[model samples]
Target: MPWQKTFTLGNKRKGCHLITNEVVNAIQDGLQNVPIGILHLFIQHTSASLTVNENCDPDVRSDMDMALDTIVPESLEWTHVDEGPDDSVSHTKASLIGSSISIPISNGRLNLGTWQGMPPPTVATGGARSRNIQASI
Candidate 1:
Protein backbone atom coordinates (compact mmCIF):
# COMPACT_ATOMS: atom_id res chain seq x y z
CA MET A 1 0.00 0.00 0.00
CA PRO A 2 1.14 3.52 -0.75
CA TRP A 3 0.45 6.31 1.69
CA GLN A 4 0.57 9.97 0.73
CA LYS A 5 0.63 13.19 2.70
CA THR A 6 1.14 16.80 1.59
CA PHE A 7 2.68 19.18 4.09
CA THR A 8 2.88 22.96 3.85
CA LEU A 9 6.24 24.80 4.17
CA GLY A 10 8.31 27.79 3.08
CA ASN A 11 7.87 31.54 3.17
CA LYS A 12 9.46 34.74 1.80
CA ARG A 13 13.06 33.64 1.34
CA LYS A 14 15.72 32.90 -1.22
CA GLY A 15 17.73 30.05 0.22
CA CYS A 16 17.80 26.41 1.25
CA HIS A 17 16.16 25.45 4.52
CA LEU A 18 16.61 22.15 6.32
CA ILE A 19 13.07 20.98 6.73
CA THR A 20 13.82 17.31 7.26
CA ASN A 21 12.43 17.26 10.79
CA GLU A 22 9.27 18.98 9.78
CA VAL A 23 8.65 16.47 7.02
CA VAL A 24 9.64 13.42 9.05
CA ASN A 25 7.60 14.36 12.10
CA ALA A 26 4.49 14.85 10.04
CA ILE A 27 4.82 11.34 8.61
CA GLN A 28 6.29 9.63 11.65
CA ASP A 29 3.14 7.71 12.47
CA GLY A 30 2.92 6.36 8.97
CA LEU A 31 6.62 5.57 8.79
CA GLN A 32 6.66 3.53 12.00
CA ASN A 33 4.38 0.95 10.46
CA VAL A 34 6.66 0.40 7.50
CA PRO A 35 9.73 -1.49 8.60
CA ILE A 36 11.30 -1.27 5.18
CA GLY A 37 10.10 0.99 2.39
CA ILE A 38 10.74 4.24 0.58
CA LEU A 39 9.82 7.79 1.44
CA HIS A 40 9.27 9.81 -1.74
CA LEU A 41 8.70 13.52 -1.52
CA PHE A 42 7.53 15.84 -4.30
CA ILE A 43 7.29 19.57 -4.06
CA GLN A 44 4.00 20.80 -5.56
CA HIS A 45 5.29 24.10 -6.85
CA THR A 46 7.75 25.30 -9.42
CA SER A 47 10.69 27.68 -8.70
CA ALA A 48 11.53 25.69 -5.57
CA SER A 49 13.18 22.30 -5.32
CA LEU A 50 14.25 19.53 -2.94
CA THR A 51 17.73 18.25 -2.25
CA VAL A 52 19.62 16.22 0.36
CA ASN A 53 22.74 17.86 1.73
CA GLU A 54 24.82 18.61 4.82
CA ASN A 55 22.66 19.22 7.92
CA CYS A 56 24.71 19.98 11.04
CA ASP A 57 25.94 23.43 10.08
CA PRO A 58 23.72 26.43 9.46
CA ASP A 59 26.44 27.90 7.30
CA VAL A 60 25.99 25.15 4.74
CA ARG A 61 22.40 26.13 4.10
CA SER A 62 23.25 29.79 3.77
CA ASP A 63 26.17 28.89 1.59
CA MET A 64 23.88 26.89 -0.64
CA ASP A 65 21.84 30.00 -1.22
CA MET A 66 24.92 31.96 -2.05
CA ALA A 67 26.09 29.30 -4.44
CA LEU A 68 22.80 29.28 -6.26
CA ASP A 69 22.76 33.04 -6.44
CA THR A 70 26.19 32.94 -7.98
CA ILE A 71 25.22 30.29 -10.50
CA VAL A 72 21.91 31.91 -11.40
CA PRO A 73 22.81 35.52 -10.95
CA GLU A 74 20.22 38.14 -11.90
CA SER A 75 22.66 39.84 -14.23
CA LEU A 76 21.63 37.76 -17.21
CA GLU A 77 18.92 38.73 -19.66
CA TRP A 78 15.71 36.76 -19.02
CA THR A 79 12.69 36.64 -21.32
CA HIS A 80 9.87 35.82 -18.90
CA VAL A 81 9.58 38.56 -16.35
CA ASP A 82 5.82 38.96 -16.13
CA GLU A 83 6.07 38.71 -12.36
CA GLY A 84 9.55 40.12 -11.94
CA PRO A 85 13.20 39.53 -12.79
CA ASP A 86 13.23 36.49 -10.54
CA ASP A 87 10.52 34.79 -12.60
CA SER A 88 12.65 33.23 -15.31
CA VAL A 89 15.47 32.68 -12.87
CA SER A 90 13.26 30.80 -10.45
CA HIS A 91 11.97 28.44 -13.13
CA THR A 92 15.47 27.74 -14.33
CA LYS A 93 16.71 26.94 -10.85
CA ALA A 94 13.78 24.63 -10.22
CA SER A 95 14.58 22.69 -13.36
CA LEU A 96 18.25 22.49 -12.51
CA ILE A 97 17.76 21.27 -8.92
CA GLY A 98 14.50 19.31 -9.33
CA SER A 99 11.38 18.99 -7.19
CA SER A 100 11.35 15.61 -5.44
CA ILE A 101 13.30 13.38 -3.10
CA SER A 102 13.33 9.67 -2.28
CA ILE A 103 14.77 8.07 0.83
CA PRO A 104 14.89 4.51 2.08
CA ILE A 105 12.99 3.69 5.25
CA SER A 106 14.74 1.44 7.74
CA ASN A 107 13.32 0.42 11.09
CA GLY A 108 10.83 3.24 10.90
CA ARG A 109 13.53 5.82 10.28
CA LEU A 110 14.76 7.57 7.17
CA ASN A 111 18.02 6.04 6.00
CA LEU A 112 19.83 9.20 5.04
CA GLY A 113 23.55 9.76 5.04
CA THR A 114 25.04 11.23 8.25
CA TRP A 115 25.22 14.67 6.65
CA GLN A 116 22.16 14.38 4.43
CA GLY A 117 18.83 16.12 4.89
CA MET A 118 16.28 17.49 2.45
CA PRO A 119 15.44 21.15 1.91
CA PRO A 120 13.25 22.73 -0.68
CA PRO A 121 15.75 25.22 -2.04
CA THR A 122 14.23 28.64 -2.40
CA VAL A 123 15.21 30.59 -5.47
CA ALA A 124 14.27 33.86 -7.14
CA THR A 125 12.12 36.56 -5.61
CA GLY A 126 9.14 35.61 -7.75
CA GLY A 127 8.74 32.12 -6.35
CA ALA A 128 5.93 31.01 -4.11
CA ARG A 129 6.05 32.48 -0.62
CA SER A 130 4.85 29.16 0.80
CA ARG A 131 4.97 25.66 -0.64
CA ASN A 132 3.79 22.11 -0.15
CA ILE A 133 5.51 18.76 -0.45
CA GLN A 134 3.64 15.54 -1.10
CA ALA A 135 5.23 12.63 0.72
CA SER A 136 4.36 9.20 -0.58
CA ILE A 137 5.21 6.08 1.34
Candidate 2:
Protein backbone atom coordinates (compact mmCIF):
# COMPACT_ATOMS: atom_id res chain seq x y z
CA MET A 1 0.00 0.00 0.00
CA PRO A 2 1.11 3.57 -0.67
CA TRP A 3 0.60 6.37 1.82
CA GLN A 4 0.59 10.05 1.04
CA LYS A 5 0.83 13.04 3.39
CA THR A 6 1.09 16.77 2.90
CA PHE A 7 2.35 19.42 5.31
CA THR A 8 3.54 23.00 5.28
CA LEU A 9 6.99 24.00 6.46
CA GLY A 10 7.39 27.37 8.09
CA ASN A 11 9.38 30.21 6.56
CA LYS A 12 13.02 29.57 5.68
CA ARG A 13 15.54 32.33 5.14
CA LYS A 14 17.02 33.33 1.74
CA GLY A 15 19.49 30.45 1.52
CA CYS A 16 19.83 26.74 1.82
CA HIS A 17 18.50 25.15 5.02
CA LEU A 18 18.82 21.61 6.28
CA ILE A 19 15.36 20.06 6.47
CA THR A 20 16.07 16.38 6.96
CA ASN A 21 14.80 16.41 10.54
CA GLU A 22 11.69 18.35 9.62
CA VAL A 23 10.82 15.88 6.87
CA VAL A 24 11.54 12.87 9.05
CA ASN A 25 9.57 14.10 12.05
CA ALA A 26 6.59 15.02 9.94
CA ILE A 27 6.38 11.55 8.44
CA GLN A 28 7.69 9.51 11.35
CA ASP A 29 4.30 8.11 12.29
CA GLY A 30 3.52 7.00 8.77
CA LEU A 31 6.94 5.47 8.26
CA GLN A 32 6.78 3.41 11.43
CA ASN A 33 4.48 0.90 9.79
CA VAL A 34 6.28 0.66 6.48
CA PRO A 35 9.43 -1.42 6.56
CA ILE A 36 10.48 -0.68 3.00
CA GLY A 37 9.46 1.82 0.37
CA ILE A 38 10.39 4.98 -1.44
CA LEU A 39 9.73 8.40 0.05
CA HIS A 40 9.11 11.14 -2.47
CA LEU A 41 9.14 14.77 -1.37
CA PHE A 42 7.83 17.57 -3.55
CA ILE A 43 8.05 21.29 -2.99
CA GLN A 44 5.16 23.34 -4.38
CA HIS A 45 7.07 26.53 -5.10
CA THR A 46 8.92 27.71 -8.19
CA SER A 47 11.15 30.28 -6.55
CA ALA A 48 12.83 27.70 -4.39
CA SER A 49 14.11 24.17 -4.88
CA LEU A 50 15.38 21.05 -3.09
CA THR A 51 18.66 19.18 -3.32
CA VAL A 52 20.55 16.57 -1.33
CA ASN A 53 24.13 17.43 -0.46
CA GLU A 54 26.70 17.74 2.30
CA ASN A 55 25.22 18.27 5.78
CA CYS A 56 28.23 18.47 8.06
CA ASP A 57 29.47 21.86 6.98
CA PRO A 58 27.67 25.17 6.96
CA ASP A 59 30.23 26.66 4.58
CA VAL A 60 29.00 24.39 1.85
CA ARG A 61 25.59 26.02 2.04
CA SER A 62 26.97 29.54 1.98
CA ASP A 63 29.35 28.69 -0.80
CA MET A 64 26.53 27.28 -2.81
CA ASP A 65 24.55 30.51 -2.38
CA MET A 66 27.52 32.52 -3.54
CA ALA A 67 28.09 30.30 -6.52
CA LEU A 68 24.49 30.43 -7.55
CA ASP A 69 24.40 34.17 -7.22
CA THR A 70 27.42 34.40 -9.47
CA ILE A 71 25.99 31.99 -11.98
CA VAL A 72 22.58 33.68 -12.04
CA PRO A 73 23.51 37.31 -11.56
CA GLU A 74 20.46 39.49 -10.86
CA SER A 75 21.85 42.21 -13.10
CA LEU A 76 21.06 40.25 -16.21
CA GLU A 77 18.32 41.46 -18.54
CA TRP A 78 15.04 39.87 -17.60
CA THR A 79 11.61 40.98 -18.74
CA HIS A 80 9.88 39.23 -15.86
CA VAL A 81 10.95 41.92 -13.43
CA ASP A 82 7.40 42.91 -12.54
CA GLU A 83 8.08 41.25 -9.20
CA GLY A 84 11.74 42.28 -8.79
CA PRO A 85 15.26 41.50 -9.95
CA ASP A 86 15.32 38.35 -7.92
CA ASP A 87 12.21 36.95 -9.50
CA SER A 88 13.73 35.91 -12.81
CA VAL A 89 16.93 34.69 -11.22
CA SER A 90 14.96 32.79 -8.62
CA HIS A 91 13.11 30.90 -11.30
CA THR A 92 16.33 30.09 -13.10
CA LYS A 93 18.05 28.81 -10.00
CA ALA A 94 15.03 26.78 -9.03
CA SER A 95 14.98 25.20 -12.46
CA LEU A 96 18.67 24.41 -12.27
CA ILE A 97 18.42 22.86 -8.83
CA GLY A 98 15.01 21.23 -9.12
CA SER A 99 12.08 20.97 -6.69
CA SER A 100 11.71 17.37 -5.55
CA ILE A 101 13.61 14.39 -4.23
CA SER A 102 13.24 10.68 -3.58
CA ILE A 103 14.75 8.72 -0.74
CA PRO A 104 14.67 5.13 0.35
CA ILE A 105 12.95 4.12 3.57
CA SER A 106 14.32 1.30 5.69
CA ASN A 107 13.43 0.25 9.19
CA GLY A 108 11.24 3.29 9.52
CA ARG A 109 14.13 5.61 8.85
CA LEU A 110 15.31 7.58 5.82
CA ASN A 111 18.27 5.96 4.15
CA LEU A 112 20.47 8.98 3.63
CA GLY A 113 24.21 8.96 3.47
CA THR A 114 26.21 9.92 6.55
CA TRP A 115 27.25 13.22 5.03
CA GLN A 116 24.26 13.58 2.76
CA GLY A 117 21.11 15.62 3.43
CA MET A 118 18.40 17.68 1.79
CA PRO A 119 18.41 21.48 1.74
CA PRO A 120 15.76 23.77 0.36
CA PRO A 121 17.71 26.38 -1.58
CA THR A 122 15.56 29.47 -1.38
CA VAL A 123 16.53 32.34 -3.59
CA ALA A 124 15.43 35.80 -4.89
CA THR A 125 12.27 36.30 -2.77
CA GLY A 126 12.56 37.75 0.70
CA GLY A 127 10.67 37.86 4.02
CA ALA A 128 8.91 34.97 5.73
CA ARG A 129 7.85 32.19 3.39
CA SER A 130 6.34 28.73 3.67
CA ARG A 131 6.85 25.64 1.50
CA ASN A 132 4.06 23.20 0.85
CA ILE A 133 5.82 19.85 1.01
CA GLN A 134 4.15 16.61 0.00
CA ALA A 135 5.45 13.22 1.05
CA SER A 136 4.45 9.92 -0.48
CA ILE A 137 5.37 6.63 1.15
Candidate 3:
Protein backbone atom coordinates (compact mmCIF):
# COMPACT_ATOMS: atom_id res chain seq x y z
CA MET A 1 0.00 0.00 0.00
CA PRO A 2 1.02 3.56 -0.64
CA TRP A 3 0.51 6.40 1.79
CA GLN A 4 1.08 10.12 1.98
CA LYS A 5 1.43 12.52 4.88
CA THR A 6 1.89 16.25 5.39
CA PHE A 7 3.85 17.83 8.20
CA THR A 8 3.45 21.41 9.32
CA LEU A 9 6.49 23.08 10.83
CA GLY A 10 6.81 26.38 12.65
CA ASN A 11 10.06 27.85 11.48
CA LYS A 12 11.83 30.84 12.95
CA ARG A 13 13.58 32.08 9.83
CA LYS A 14 12.95 32.66 6.14
CA GLY A 15 15.93 30.56 5.08
CA CYS A 16 16.92 26.91 5.35
CA HIS A 17 15.26 25.35 8.37
CA LEU A 18 16.38 21.92 9.47
CA ILE A 19 13.52 19.75 10.48
CA THR A 20 13.77 17.71 13.67
CA ASN A 21 13.41 14.05 14.66
CA GLU A 22 9.74 14.68 15.30
CA VAL A 23 9.19 15.17 11.61
CA VAL A 24 11.04 11.97 10.83
CA ASN A 25 9.08 10.24 13.53
CA ALA A 26 5.88 11.34 11.86
CA ILE A 27 7.05 9.89 8.54
CA GLN A 28 8.12 6.69 10.25
CA ASP A 29 4.81 6.47 12.01
CA GLY A 30 3.07 6.52 8.67
CA LEU A 31 5.46 4.03 7.09
CA GLN A 32 5.60 1.57 9.93
CA ASN A 33 5.62 -2.05 8.75
CA VAL A 34 5.31 -1.10 5.13
CA PRO A 35 8.19 -3.09 3.75
CA ILE A 36 10.63 -1.86 1.13
CA GLY A 37 9.72 1.38 -0.62
CA ILE A 38 10.82 4.84 -1.56
CA LEU A 39 10.03 7.78 0.66
CA HIS A 40 9.84 11.18 -1.00
CA LEU A 41 9.77 14.36 1.05
CA PHE A 42 9.01 17.69 -0.55
CA ILE A 43 8.73 21.24 0.67
CA GLN A 44 6.01 23.29 -0.99
CA HIS A 45 7.51 26.75 -1.18
CA THR A 46 10.01 28.82 -3.09
CA SER A 47 11.31 31.07 -0.34
CA ALA A 48 12.14 28.13 1.90
CA SER A 49 14.28 25.01 1.59
CA LEU A 50 14.89 21.65 3.24
CA THR A 51 17.98 19.66 4.14
CA VAL A 52 19.33 16.88 6.34
CA ASN A 53 21.95 18.02 8.80
CA GLU A 54 23.77 16.96 11.94
CA ASN A 55 21.26 17.13 14.76
CA CYS A 56 23.70 16.17 17.50
CA ASP A 57 24.68 19.76 18.20
CA PRO A 58 22.60 22.92 18.06
CA ASP A 59 25.77 24.90 17.35
CA VAL A 60 26.18 23.08 14.07
CA ARG A 61 22.85 24.39 12.90
CA SER A 62 23.68 27.88 14.02
CA ASP A 63 27.02 27.77 12.23
CA MET A 64 25.50 26.43 9.03
CA ASP A 65 22.76 29.04 9.08
CA MET A 66 25.27 31.76 9.68
CA ALA A 67 27.42 30.49 6.84
CA LEU A 68 24.52 30.63 4.43
CA ASP A 69 23.76 34.18 5.46
CA THR A 70 27.37 35.11 4.82
CA ILE A 71 27.38 33.42 1.43
CA VAL A 72 24.02 34.91 0.43
CA PRO A 73 23.89 38.09 2.38
CA GLU A 74 20.65 40.06 2.09
CA SER A 75 22.45 43.29 1.22
CA LEU A 76 23.83 41.90 -2.03
CA GLU A 77 22.93 43.82 -5.18
CA TRP A 78 19.80 42.01 -6.27
CA THR A 79 17.26 43.28 -8.78
CA HIS A 80 14.31 41.33 -7.47
CA VAL A 81 13.76 43.64 -4.54
CA ASP A 82 10.05 44.21 -5.23
CA GLU A 83 9.20 42.34 -2.08
CA GLY A 84 11.97 43.32 0.28
CA PRO A 85 15.71 43.07 0.87
CA ASP A 86 15.32 39.46 1.90
CA ASP A 87 13.02 38.50 -0.96
CA SER A 88 15.76 37.92 -3.50
CA VAL A 89 18.06 36.41 -0.94
CA SER A 90 15.31 34.04 0.12
CA HIS A 91 14.87 32.78 -3.43
CA THR A 92 18.60 32.48 -3.92
CA LYS A 93 19.01 30.48 -0.74
CA ALA A 94 16.12 28.24 -1.66
CA SER A 95 17.65 27.54 -5.03
CA LEU A 96 20.96 26.65 -3.45
CA ILE A 97 19.46 24.67 -0.58
CA GLY A 98 16.86 22.84 -2.73
CA SER A 99 13.23 22.03 -2.06
CA SER A 100 13.01 18.29 -1.54
CA ILE A 101 14.72 15.06 -0.53
CA SER A 102 14.06 11.39 -1.23
CA ILE A 103 15.22 8.49 0.89
CA PRO A 104 14.84 4.74 0.68
CA ILE A 105 12.90 2.92 3.33
CA SER A 106 13.75 -0.58 4.52
CA ASN A 107 12.05 -2.84 7.03
CA GLY A 108 9.60 -0.03 7.64
CA ARG A 109 12.29 2.28 8.94
CA LEU A 110 14.32 5.20 7.66
CA ASN A 111 18.04 4.70 7.09
CA LEU A 112 19.62 7.55 9.01
CA GLY A 113 22.75 7.95 11.04
CA THR A 114 23.00 8.27 14.81
CA TRP A 115 23.97 11.95 14.76
CA GLN A 116 21.85 12.89 11.77
CA GLY A 117 18.35 14.26 11.69
CA MET A 118 15.96 16.35 9.64
CA PRO A 119 16.90 20.02 9.46
CA PRO A 120 14.23 22.26 10.80
CA PRO A 121 12.73 24.79 8.39
CA THR A 122 13.96 28.34 8.93
CA VAL A 123 13.20 31.88 7.82
CA ALA A 124 15.38 34.94 7.35
CA THR A 125 14.29 37.13 10.26
CA GLY A 126 13.89 34.31 12.76
CA GLY A 127 10.19 34.99 12.94
CA ALA A 128 7.30 32.59 13.12
CA ARG A 129 6.15 30.95 9.91
CA SER A 130 4.61 27.75 8.69
CA ARG A 131 6.21 25.11 6.43
CA ASN A 132 4.55 22.25 4.66
CA ILE A 133 6.47 19.03 4.05
CA GLN A 134 4.91 16.24 2.04
CA ALA A 135 6.00 12.66 2.61
CA SER A 136 5.06 9.80 0.31
CA ILE A 137 5.58 6.11 1.05
lDDT of each: 0.82, 0.84, 0.73
* Positional deviation of residue 49's Cα in model 3 after best superposition, in angstroms: 0.9
Q: After superposition, how far is residue 104 of candidate 2 from its true place, in Å?
A: 0.6
Against the true structure, what is each candidate's TM-score?
Answer: 0.90, 0.93, 0.83
After superposition, candidate 2 runs with Cα above 4 Å error: none
Q: Global lDDT for candidate 3?
A: 0.73
Those runs of model 3 whose alpha carbons end farther than 4 Å from true positions after fitting are 14-18, 120-126
* Weakest ten-residue segment in model 2 by summed lDDT: 120-129
Considering every candidate listed, which one attains the maximal TM-score?
2
lDDT (10s digit) by residue, model 3, range 1-137: 88999987665655334565567677767778978888888878777777777878778887877888898887778888775677777777778888887777788877767777777433543345677889888
**Which of the predicted structures, 1 or 3, would earn the higher lDDT when compared with the native?**
1
* Model 3 residue 89 CA deviation in Å: 0.9
Writing each residue's lDDT as its tens digit, candidate 2 over 27-108 gives 8877887788899999888888889999999999999888888998888987786666688888889999998999999988
Among residues 3 or more apart in sequence or in different chains, the pairs in candidate 1 whose N, CA or C atoms overlap within 3 Å are: none
Candidate 2 residue pairs that clash = none
